[model samples]
Target chain A: MTDARILTEALRDPATVAQLDAAGWTALLAIARAEQLIGTLAHRLAGLPMPSAAARVLEDARASAEQGRIAALWEAEMARRALAPTGMPVILLKGTAYAAAGLAAGTGRAIGDLDILVPRARLEEAEAVLLQAGWEWVKPDPYDDLYYRRWMHELPPLIHRERDRMIDVHHTILPLTARVTPDADALIADSVVLENGLRILAPHDMLCHAAAHLFADGDLAGGLRNLWDIHCLAGEHGIAGVEARAVHHGLEAAVGRALRLADRLYGGGLRYGQGRDRDMLYLRRLLARDDWGRPTRKLTRLGFYVRSHWLRMPPALLAQHLFTKWRKTAAQ
Target chain B: MRHATTLRIGPVGFRVGSDWRAPIAALNDLYRDYPQPDDGIPDFNVHLFAARPWRRVLRPSVHIGGDFVIPDAAPLPLVQGLLAAEMGMNLQMALGQRRYLLLHASAVERDGRALLMTGMSGAGKSTLAALLMAAGWRLMGDEFALLDPVTGLIHGFPRLISLKNEAIGVIERALPRARFGPRLEGTPKGTIRHLVPDARAISVMAEPAAPRLILFPSYGFAAAERAVLPSETFVRLTQASTNYVALAERGFGALTGLVRRVPARALDYPDTATVLEQVERMWSAG
Candidate 1:
């Protein structure tokens, strides 16, 4: 295993923290920050008599994470109130959902932007309602807006004109051009309403969505945090529940891969530490090393950047999109 | 990227890494009087690297990077690398710091009590705080006055006094023996220079001071003063603080406690002398 794997293991181990010096603490914090797990680290290491230097960093992380959580909740509330006019069932996804549902995954996660999945048919109605309620297009570029509207699973990103907050309203999890299209209807239909009048994806579907996010959509930028979310959800749903849910969504292989990677990275020295060595090596190579959690010089981010784009779209569209992007950048 | 140095100012320790030796050398010279952190571990890290590899040799701009970053911030030329480092450090603290309610103010101490003066930009708070320091008042800080959330005690962070424009010349003449950085001209913020804080301030940076006076100073005005009601002061302070909203309820309670106990006065002064006199009078009364 690499230093990141060691740091990942140590993240939950108090005994390991005791042995870490300044350099170790610095590396761990940077890795955790890059992975968006610093808050989780802060939460886990709360009781230990942490050194002032390390403790101060965690304090800062915890404060930032807390602020993000609060802002996310506030944005969700605003979105809920805005969507009420259309009477659309606005199901919160990812961080916002975890937070609204009081899930363990929400504890220290710093949600970047608000993500809410609405019914595909209601997408236009939801967009109009949000617009009238103050959300404006974040990407005002005509081509970009058109690209998102025509080819993407979600509308172009919206920013609350008054609050300056950005939110992504998705009709489905994966992009429309992606190879694997999960049944958005099932996920949306299974959403459970919370006491706060907000809706969240059901336990099994939540696990499936997290797996899909890691394997299908993202470039594994914050893969560790995403895995932690999966870990937390899996713990709540139990292994059988997660397996059944993934099987139902046709994401059993993706879920298994994520679980294996998690075991390799975070669950060593435990009963579930029997991840395949070959899988670990391949997954590690594919992940971007320039990310905060990665420090290995041999692994270049350029390799995975293209791969993520390829995974999100087909070859012809990807080639055309890349060309257009290159031309635009060159012109600028 | 190799020239690096670690130094501590008050409670905060910083590891400043630079691609060019110039910035690191300059920081070392300027901060020689200040002590390094007891432990080598830094509270914050600042990386001053060139934006592009070609930029490292051609035009050579210093781009700030670290644990906390504003991705779109413009790069600074090599000549102003030290300033870039300082700005980067300040940026990280302002954005990342959570243990304290950070106030965008200048501070000075007298008899274990701190005088925090905050106002709009060009308010002359920095200049007044420097003048007070010259008058034997211990300068607690200039850029940020950190108020501990639990105790409400002000931590001393007497970083290099960033005197700009005419304020640079003002301090240059005021203290002949004072150490000052090179007179940098024609940059982002007009002519700029830095003044090394007094050694006394450096030695006593660890000592926390109870805030005794809160002054909302307005420079270039008719010399007049008015008492700020606690309720009004709280609202104004919440605005003055950079991390008040981020810290949420703890910040609210800390600011609330400080405003209630500390007598706040809005001092509109034409010059620094009047402000100094008003501050001295307030301190004496306390």
Candidate 2:
């Protein structure tokens, strides 16, 4: 078997890690790092015996993930304080939400930017308040700013000047030009409120958002982390009405593909039917990492990059966007 | 990766891989005295690769990549591939190291105790540490000082001493027989050279020392010394640390205990001789 399969097999059954040798553990660590799932893997294999080197790396991963969790939660609280006067319920999304709700998906999760979903009507207000709270626009270019304002789901990524942490104020889950249009209002309406007056998407909606994020938005870079999220979410809150909720968001196919891939990779006892050939391609793209953590299969990566843009925008706009980006690079 | 090597520097082990042979060859030569990691497994992997396919052979530029990377770091010319590999290893420690409280300071040991010198870049800490090592103190590290939180002791990470611009000449004059890497000119940090630590530093690299004195040194100034209070020292050390916040409470406790246990002073001097005298005076006084 190929070295890449070692990561998949280990993730499917953490007990198999005990049987791994020094080389096996090295490959597993590298692949987990490449996939940005080292923290998740560390959590999965917390008690199992492994080599001392692997144990040290995993211990570091666990600590780093805890740091991420603390930072993510603190960012959410700061956003809440900033938006309190605006009277809009602050709805956290993705990693921040998982952390605030203390879900299993959040355990040992590595979070980057703080992703929050605000009402579309209150987006301008949210932007103003965040600015008042010392958040500045990261993309200063007028053209990129205009593009984000017109076509993106989030604000042009505001970063706290003093803290150096970024907060993405997303009005919806998907981009405005994407083919799949999730109901932003229903997402806010169905959000479950926390004890601290913060809100997170309900279980089914959270799963649907994770699926759409994996299959519809990105080019499957860091897809394993998203799949692990789905696996954990499904294990904690079963995928009972996730299909119907995904259909409501025009993301049923993406949700189905995500679940099947997650099950295939993590072996959660969800008996989904056989995935399509295209689903296999997605899996291949996700697993196209070599034992040394270098990316393999350039053709597959490029194909998915183009496909992600295609899913996000129409051909004409996509061409214009690509041209603008190419020009920017050339100028640089 | 066409060529690769593993090196254990103090507590951290690194597996360095390069697309070209020159960097790995240089590393093998420079680190020939160092030991390999236990079981041949590395804590971090450093990859020196070409940004593009043709770039590997055409005016080759080496991009630093590894488990953790700074995405916007500009590539260095292939001639500076050794510098790139060193930066890659440092980058991993700065971003991924959670085992210790990493201080952006230079350190040396004397009589089983450690003396830490920290300041902004171009502050002469590296030169001071190198000169002290030449003057009979054991070199602990030049780039980072690893503070073990549990034991409240500093671990020796005596990697190659990175001497920049003017300090190169000063060190070359002090230790004429010392081994040095090839002079890399016109690099980002300006004419750089790496000095191999003496045999004693490498032989006792595993030993941890109690920090007895902390100095904030600045060069190109009139000779002056001021005692830094514990509160101010705490804040300054936090700014001097890369992983202070990542280690969270353990880091806070370690740093707090260090400042309370050890006295600190800020020293400003006009030249190396004056700084050396001031350091000795402060050491005896402490």
Q: List the residue pairs that clash in candidate 2.
A: none
lDDT tens per residue, model 1, A133-249: 999988878889989987888899999988888899999888888878888999888899887667899887887888888877776667778877877776666666666667777
Per-candidate chain B TM: 0.97, 0.98
- Model 2, B171-273: lDDT tens digits are 9999999999999999988999999999999999988999999999988889999999999999999999998988988899999999999999999999988
Write model 2 residue lDDT over A1-332, tens digit each, in one string: 34366777877788998787766777788788877788888998998987777888899899888988987898899999999899897889999999989999898888999999999999999999999999999999999999999999999999999899999999999999999899989999999999988899989899999999999999998888898899989999998888888889999998888899989888886635567888778888988887678888899999999899999999999999999999999999
- Where model 2 places Cα greater than 4 Å from the true spot, the runs are A1-4, A328-332, B270-274
- Model 1, which residues run further than 4 Å from truth? A1-3, A241-250, A268-299
List CA RMSD, all candidates.
2.8, 2.0
Predicted structure with the largest lDDT when compared to the true one: 2
Model 1, residue A294: C-alpha shift (Å): 8.3
